[model samples]
Target: MQITQLPSDQRPREKLLQQGPQALSDAELLAIFFRTGIAGMNAIELAETTLSTHQSLQQLFNASLGDFCQVKGLGEAKYVQLQAVLELSKRFLQESCQRNTVFNSPEHVRHYLSLELKSRQQEVFMVLFLDNQNRLIHQDILFYGTINSASVYPREVVKAVLRHNAAAVIFAHNHPSGVAEPSEADKIITRKLISALALIDVPVLDHLIVADVSVISFAERGLI
Candidate 1:
């Protein structure tokens, strides 16, 4: 049935306005974003079909423009809108991270890192430079390509920390293979970084590994 023909309270937009966004299902939320549908399918049905095609909202959000446009009733315009929404979410999370003590709000940091690194096809190392109070001072991707002892240089990380005048640091890296477990190489490089930073009296607060569906924290696992 058409969305307009449905009862007022049952409509996605009306439901959202009345009960807040959380009251709606994923298809209802997506239907509101869609606004309209193809010849036969209503917005809700279209949204359901699209979600089924992608399997999940995460897969849909992560799809490339070509892949996204391939979906029925979707196009480049929708892809651009989706990307904008994703970037806005990432920025919001980053703003939150900057405002709070990072260690105290570890989930925010994890979410920000996930948005930044989860979809990446290659390995990247990121460092969050923190003030003495553990608020984020600066963040940077210090290394690209393979993340390992040979590729990641402690000297460059030290330079960045000094430049930012950071009191402490949190390290993060993405595993394209979707394994959140820290490898032997990961452990070795982290210890080397710890030793290098310790000489300058900067503490390594945590090391996080971003995987496909999870962010693993070294501190949480007692690996740090």
Candidate 2:
């Protein structure tokens, strides 16, 4: 059936106006972008066919310009429009990252880093920089791989703090073995970092060991 022939209240556009965008199904939302139908299909039918072919909206969004254009009814204009929206979403994520401050609680740090580093095969270290009020200013990746005394430089940590003008810092590293326990090397490095940053007046707040889905705080264990 043509969109114009559909009952006004039953139409996707009408339902969107009456109930809000969230009320629409995935196909209905995509139908709005499609706007028109081919010779034998309505816009909603074309949208359903496209969604069925792609299997998921995520797959559709990830499709390349050429891939999208390969869809019978999706031309260059529609492909570019979809690509622009996807790029805008990515830009918004980057902007959100810049606005986020360092988290204070050990649990919060674990939660934040878990999404970023939990699945990595190699060790990764991140430094959380905080202001005088203990609010997060920024975070930086200091080192990667099996973190050793030789790899993690106190000078680099100090430089990062100075660059961000941070008042305090938290050290975090992931254990690829799925064990959150700190190693002997971990303790030695924490001690050395705490002592080195002390000379520059930037207190080391905590040293965290992150594993698959757990985190251990050195400060909570009185190790730092």
Model 1, 1-224: lDDT tens digits are 88999999999999999999999999999999889999999999999999998998888988988888887899988888889989999999999999999999998999999999998888999999999999999899998885332269999999999999999999999998888899998999999999999999999999999988999999998988
Give the lDDT of residue 185 in candidate 1.
Answer: 89
Regions of model 2 farther than 4 Å from truth: 1-104, 146-150
Which pairs clash in the backbone of model 2? 102-136
Position 35, candidate 2: lDDT:
87
lDDT of 2 by residue, 1-224 (tens): 89889988668899899999999999888988888989889889889988998887756876777877777888889988987876675455434433554443444566666655555567888898888876667777888766332268888888889999989888888888878899998888889889889998989888888776578889899997
Model 1, residue pairs in steric clash = none
**Which parts of model 1 are misplaced by more than 4 Å?**
147-150
- Scored by TM-score, the top model is 1
